[model samples]
Target: MSVSEKATIICSKCSAETDFVAWKSITTDTDPIFKEKVRSGELYQCICPKCGNVTIIEYDTLYSEVDKDLTIYFVTNKDSYEKAMELLKSDEANSEEEQSGVFRVVTTRAEFREKLLIADAGYDDRAIEILKFITATHVKEVQKIKFDAALFDMQNGKYGFRFFETGKAGIFIPMVEDMYNQVVVDFSPKYPTEEKDNLEVNLNWVINIVKGNNNSFI
Candidate 1:
């Protein structure tokens, strides 16, 4: 059986302390290992009931040497996140640009396939354009992408896509290395810093995935 613990968190927006059950291992339909990482302390996130915000709780300080008590350092803006979520939920009814927020809308699977066919076609432009389209249509969905899997793991928690093998529903958009353009430097203060490290990594991985050199889904 998996063990769990109760943790208390204070809402950054409301300043109300709420209690949460921190699971040691939460088994789900997709990605069984996700819970293992959380149990191992490799990942940390929580949800606030008062404001209904799913916050990324950081246990250790960014540059702190001493081990301090784990605290709720970051509380995500639930308003925007939830708005983007609505767009994703209504993807089929919405246009390509609207679905862009939930998933990348390529012209066609052949377009992605052609890139794979080319000798030196890179994913930099394609990925950026797809992400940008999604951002422009549903700005909130861009932020909620990080928490979608965790929040909906039980129902349809598959990350981006189920697999890249072969099927219809369009090509499974692989996880790009630097998929994130902005990094949350501090959640308590609700500050964001532009960083390109994630984007660089995403490009490298997308290239490999398209070439079939790597099978690890982003």
Candidate 2:
């Protein structure tokens, strides 16, 4: 079956209001055990007038058989997306390390858990200090993460770090403590540069600091 309906969705980037027609349908099939499964749902789709974005809004069912509402969109044209994907793949294949002002710091997962414990004990200042130490001390090791950019997690507590390559970046930190305890660090390079020459210098610097030979403050 099919029915026409309308709904509104906010654009993720621009927050512009968008309206689209919704279609509803149903499906039926017989299981091998002779049981029949009946599925009925309303489907949604939207087209953004301002951005010319076309996307599926969702599908809802009375029985709650569907797991989630599905949606999709694009920020750039097809050509741009393809080109960007190509560039990203190339960067990954070549493993070219580009430096964005952002640096990625490495800490043991146990240390991350300890940091959370410190935060829970009301040692917010100490937690922050530890993070600062970890980031600054490991700056050299962070530079070797083989990415275009990286950043430390300063918000909340010391959770993990992020690495950026090609046109994208990833957060590799696990969430600990309450939902808010995970730290988020974002780094964007001022200008793109290669890490070939500086990688060794950074590695040695981080090694020295981790070995407690360097007394520099974070």
Candidate 3:
């Protein structure tokens, strides 16, 4: 189900108010046009009628793909996460049916897009985040800057990334195939599960394992 409503947006360039449609939930299976807009990131994008300024109107939205077996609650604020956690911990959360596949909570437009890209690439988003963490931290010359975006090239088996420096986006860095493969191989074994129900994984869950923090999440 795709839910939308008309809303007003202020233009950054002219400080003029404009009206646009904002989506509250996006189900990719049936509504592909909106889905394409999500991929292209134009669903709530608004152009100022007065000054031609472009901006995106962001709000809380649930992104789901039943065929892909993925559900991500994209929350814009901390309160939403707390509320979502409460829902996840309810009796419905204990149902065997609900526990069948990946369930996650993500914040930020970038992470929301990353989830879609990762699923499209037939790769795990958590694994890719770990790779991002490594790239942003351990790598030497690359570590000198912070990357704002990462795009995976499944065709070439490479990661295409860009960074924001002085309001400028850096070009794609050289592909690191070895590191990607190494992370996929090395990270999976950290928590091995024979059961099919346990296929979904995330960085927070991994962090819990490393920190010996035992908290229940599905």
List all candidate RMSDs to the true structure. Answer: 19.2, 20.0, 5.6
TM-score, every prediction: 0.23, 0.21, 0.70
Measure candidate 3: CA RMSD. 5.6
Worst 10 residues of 3 by lDDT: 192-201
Which candidate gets the maximum TM-score versus the true structure? 3
Of 1 and 2, the candidate ahead on TM-score is: 1
Per-residue lDDT tens digits of candidate 3, residues 154-206?
33555544444554656555447677678778766655352222223444555
Q: Is candidate 1 or candidate 2 better by lDDT?
A: 2
Query: What lDDT would candidate 1 get against the real structure?
Result: 0.33
- Per-residue lDDT tens digits for candidate 2, residues 1-218, read 22346677887656789876543322112111111211111133455678866565543321111212111111124454455335434647338554232111112222323333333344332223334345433543764444554433334544545445674755444324442232212111211234222221123433443455343433
Q: Please list the residue runs of candidate 2 whose C-alpha ends up more than 4 Å from where it truly belongs after superposition.
A: 1-46, 49-143, 151-158, 170-215
lDDT of each: 0.33, 0.36, 0.64
Clashing pairs in 1: 84-141, 176-202, 177-201, 177-202, 178-198, 178-199, 178-202
lDDT of 1 by residue, 67-160 (tens): 1211111112455334434543463534343211112211222322222222122223334433433333242354332211110001133223
lDDT of 2 at 167: 41
User: Model 1 compared with the native: what TM-score?
Assistant: 0.23
